[model samples]
Target: MEHGIVTFLTDYGIDGPALARAVEERGLDGLFLTEHTHIPTSRETPWPNGPDLPRHYSHTLDPFVALGAMAAVTERITLGTAVSLILQHNPIGLAKAVASVDHIAGGRVELGVGPGWNREEMANHGIDPRTRTARMLEHIAAMRAIWENDEAEFHGRFVDFDPIWSWPKPVRVPPVLIGGEGPTVLDRVLSHGDGWMPRRAGLDEIDALAARITELQTRAADAGRGHMLVTVFGVRPDAKELAAYADAGVDGVLFTLPAEGPDTVLPLLDEWAALVA
Candidate 1:
């Protein structure tokens, strides 16, 4: 299985170029950055992970810009967004940004996308949280149209645009990984995404995750789509657990690094790299 790292690249954390170089030097396969455009001060939407929202959520550097910086200093490691908030951005601009980064990375870019969880944040973006899923779908479709065509036009409930030109199309269409573990996530992965990126609940959930992978692959085969990739996010560095994931057909596992400077982060990377080796 592919071993990678995912972290919220924040202003307070290790900078992009240094972190990317460290990850590559350690022989990690990929480095994925998390995104949060801005955090609303209302604190209305409870954070899923804990009672208090983490500082990194509000301090994250823009993923595309950071990834671009990372790409300039790294040669082999893949760069990606762990889950870009699709409903919060304009698709045309995002497409160009992603494609530009892909060019900088020499085609090593993956886009993991989802409808985000912060209700107030979405509201601030003029997005209705209830309609976020539908909006996310439309945004991705519109972005894909822009990426794949010289002159692209899209007319949908959320995204509508006339045929226009956008330059630096991705070295290739970056693989779209649908991020969510909801009941309907598989359907979205099959229909619109190139892969399934779900968070690991715990070791106990491995069996169920395996079952879901089987279901997704079976459905994909029936639909004539082959080999759906499954990458678990926020994975702990446990050898037995990783073995179980590989046996269960997970394509990759991303270990999360806390948003900290090299003093705290680099040692962990070395440990995880040793584990991977």
Candidate 2:
């Protein structure tokens, strides 16, 4: 069980199976692939995490391909697209891919998604930056329908699809996580998602958000959904800070290894294992 998993999020461009084997050998609980379709050298929007955050934000193999490879080799470790460029994908295609990956991994997959902010990136994929929020919400709705229904359909301003058969339905529907921090996004998370993952929303904010989420969960009890999880992002190795989050109702702490290579990564994994051990 994931008593406390030190999950990995990386721009890893290695043999996924071999890497996963190493992780399993050293005893890690899960592997998550962080997303970045590309990094525009000339960008206007500041990086969300911070100016000093490393370039691991980009420059890596596709998360899905890498996670799929990891799934092929690992017997029990969980796999996920920690946060995919969900806005850029066709809902049907993504639903199918997620189901396929979950099947290969014996039904272990969590779809962490967000309203992507990079303007150039969204434009490259022909998605209007102005409508990203609405687009993402519709995409979420459509993806859920495809996952939960044999003959799925959606009728919305942006995602109108006729009833159609979808196959090899996931043995279990993957958890849908909404990532982004803001009141509107929080409302969306409370109403639509299965979990809330506001990555890089510093510790203080996370503590406050945790309280707000509890209030929302209490309201949702009327609708029969009070078991949503809260997961921290880019978690550091400070035990006190980590404990603060745990005290705030967080269910997981997901972090990314530095972008350099395994030398920098394996030590951190060992350190993390020691902490949770």
Candidate 3:
């Protein structure tokens, strides 16, 4: 299975170019950055992982800009978003940014997208959290139209546009990986995504996760969509667990890295590199 790293590239963490270079030099297959445009200070929406939000949530650098910098410094590693919050950005503008970065990266871009968890954050973007799934899907469809056609147009409940011209189409349409572990996520993946990216909760969840992957693939095959890639996000560098995932037909695993400086981060990269090797 392909091994990769995922991290929140915060203002205080190891910078993108350096981190990308380190990942590539150590023979990792990909480097994926997390995204959070900004955090709402209301503190009303509870964090999914814990009581307090990590410092990186508000401090993250823009994923596309960081990925662009990473692209300039690296040659072989895939550059991607772990999960870009799709409902927060204008589809046309987001499409342009992704395509421009994909062009700069020579098509080495994978866009993992999700309807994010923060209610206040969505509210700040004028998005109703209840309708976010539909909006996210529409955003993706609109972006796909923009990427695939010379004069693209889309008419949807959330996104509507007359035929319009956009420049520097991606070297290819970057594969859209649907991100989330919700029960309905597989349905979304089969309908709109090139791949499925689910966060593995723990080593204990591997068997159940494998069964879900099988179900996803079988359903895709039945629908005539061949081989949906399954990438487990937030994995740890555990050999036995990785082998189990490989046996279960996962295409890739992205291990999480803490938002830390080189002294703390580089050694962990070395440890992960040993596993990759």
* RMSD per model, one decimal: 0.8, 2.6, 0.9
Best prediction by lDDT: 1
CA RMSD (A), model 2: 2.6
- The 10-residue segment of model 2 with minimum total lDDT is 1-10
Task: Give each model's whole-structure lDDT.
Answer: 0.93, 0.73, 0.92
The residue pairs that clash in candidate 1, if any, are none
Kindly report which residue pairs in candidate 2 clash with one another. Answer: none
Better of 1 and 3 by lDDT: 1
TM accuracy, model 3 = 0.98
lDDT of 1 at 142: 94
Angstrom error at residue 237, model 2: 1.3
Error of 2 at 127 (Å): 1.4
lDDT of 1: 0.93
Q: Once model 2 is optimally superposed onto the true structure by TM-score, how far is the C-alpha of residue 217 displaced, in angstroms?
A: 2.3
Candidate 3: tens digits of C-alpha lDDT, residues 149-249: 99999999999899999988999999999999888999999988999999875768888888999999999999999899888899979888889889888
Better of 2 and 3 by lDDT: 3
